[model samples]
Target: MKPQVILFDLDDTLTESKQKVSDEMAQVFSRLLENNKAAIVSGAKFEQQLNQFINFLPKDSNLKNFFSFPQNATECMTFDGKIWAKEYSFSLSNEEITEITNALNKVLEETKIIENEISYGERIENRGAQITFSALGQEAPVSAKKTWDPDQIKRRDLQKRLEEIIPQYEIVIGGMTSIDITKKGINKTKAVNWLSEKLDLPVSSMLYIGDSLFPGGNDAIVIQTGIPVMETKNPKQTTGIIDSFLKENVV
Candidate 1:
């Protein structure tokens, strides 16, 4: 069945980790937006989303049909033809940020995983609504990020430790080398539910595609929303999925 809207996860599903959207992907994705409503939900900040994905799209693309749920959907942004506006945001308090960051630091010290590694940038970032810990640092190369945690064992271990330290916030593994934390109940599921109400469509009318749908993965939370999902391992697989969507007479 054709969906009223299609939702996507950004990092590995739509593009490489922390990389810009490809020309071919932008073309196909723009085509998809012409007739279908689409949304990108990621743990990335709004600036990263624009720099990595939104900036690559053709200017003529249908911005009205596109939505961005950055910071693990703790914030939502939509285009208003002339400008992108925030529909809603759930920002963290300064106290909450401090607590989360402190917990992250404690866990990192206990694990000592960073002792021998070369970090690219800030290891922990306060993204307003969400705090993210990128194991190899925020600006780590894609090759390094991919090779650092192919099995997610290291991140899962870290996530376990962080959860124990800060039990009030939501923590999940995302991308290749990042752990994202948000307020309890603030997640991709909330984003989809918000969009469903905004569009006056049922949750079942949307389709989600992502790379991390396994248990404990960030994308796994959306499964609770009962939206149909297609899992892809990488951007290439995601492109093929988009191609199939284009072949369908979806409107």
Candidate 2:
């Protein structure tokens, strides 16, 4: 089961919440490259995640790859810091974005959550085509976010309710409080499967590391395709799982 390719989830798996890769995580990635190249599969925009981890990884390794901008992002590169093959992204009109934002804004005003809701990260992202709804604004506190949607029950309910009002949009739960709204095909599973096919690897040969795998979690659908999944309890523990997978398969 030696992985020809290893894919990592950016947030909470390789790094702390809404933070850059830690020195310790960097070391693990370095180890991964010694035998097999690794790729990052994330819901963040392609440029955003790359900006976060590029400094940590060796730029000379052409084997390194990344899959970013989940749903709307379609480019997969061979570590040139650029993509060779870009899958198409579904986009929404400016009016659509404005309307959605306005609705969410109204909700925020009514609930008065905006005052207490400290934005820890980036939200309202335009991945060339898809749109996101990041609760902590992409930089929110993990403890606060957990408190925001303890079981993701609230988010799921919100998604269903939103769909009733805006049936035209496709809403998918993201790595954090964010929600990805795009065309029907915009999902991490499709992106991962596409990358696997392009790499000539099977779903089983590749292990996907992600934090949000619970019901209505973003990475949950990615697991639905029969891909072998390595669930990460925390970023600090990711190295251990990666080590075990590498040892179990490579050794």
Candidate 3:
């Protein structure tokens, strides 16, 4: 059956981590809005998604059919041709934000990982609804980020420690070198539920695509919704999948 809504992960699944969406992928993605309501559900903030992907889409693309779920779905926004309008946000309070960042700093200090490694920029970023810790720094080159935690061993360890320190928050590995933290139950699955309900589509009528659907990855939580899922290795594979979906379902 053809999906009524198609959701995507913004990083490696849609484009290279932190890289701008290429014209090829943007064209394919624009075609998706021709048939289905599409959304980019990612751990990055809206600004990141705007710069990386939305800005590359064709001017004729159907903006109303597109949704943005950034900060691991803690925030939702939709485009209106002129600007993005917020649908909702699970913003953190100042006290909660301070506590989370303090815990992150303590973990980094005790682990000595950040101290031993050569750093680039601010490692911890506050994204209103979520706090992200980039193990290699946010502005690090893709080559450096890719090599930092290919197998996710280091991040898993950090996650375990962070979980213990901040049990109230949700912690998961995201992108190539970042760990994302949001309120418990406000992960990607929340966005899935919201999008499904907002569109009046059942879980069976939606499809999710991501590189990190495996257990412990950031996108893993989405599988709990029981929506049909397709795993892609990279943006190239994602483009091919979109092309095939359109071809098979063409009217």
Number of the top candidate by TM-score?
Answer: 3
Candidate 2 wrongly placed segments (more than 4 Å): 62-78, 81-88, 93-99, 102-123, 245-251
Question: Mind giving the per-residue lDDT tens digits that candidate 2 earns over 73-185?
Answer: 34454444454445455567788777666655655455454466678656566665567777778666677776776666656765776676566766777765777776555
lDDT of each: 0.91, 0.66, 0.89
For TM-score, candidate 1 versus 2, the one ahead is 1
Q: Give the per-residue lDDT digits (tens) of candidate 1, residues 1-251.
A: 78999999998899987878888899999999999999999999999999999989999999899999999899999998898899999999999999999999999899998889998999999999999989888889888887998888998899889878898999988888888999988999988899999999999989999988988777989999999988999888888888888899655
| Candidates ranked, most accurate by TM-score first | 3, 1, 2
Error of 1 at 126 (Å): 1.1
- Model 1 ranges off by over 4 Å: none
Compare the candidates by lDDT and give the number of the best one: 1
The C-alpha RMSD of each candidate to the native structure, in angstroms, is 1.5, 3.3, 1.2
Error of 2 at 95 (Å): 4.8
Task: Show how many residue pairs clash in every candidate, following the order shown.
Answer: 0, 9, 0
Clashing pairs in 3: none
Rank the models by lDDT, top first. Answer: 1, 3, 2
RMSD of 3: 1.2
TM-score of 3: 0.96
Q: What is candidate 2's CA lDDT for residue 121?
A: 59
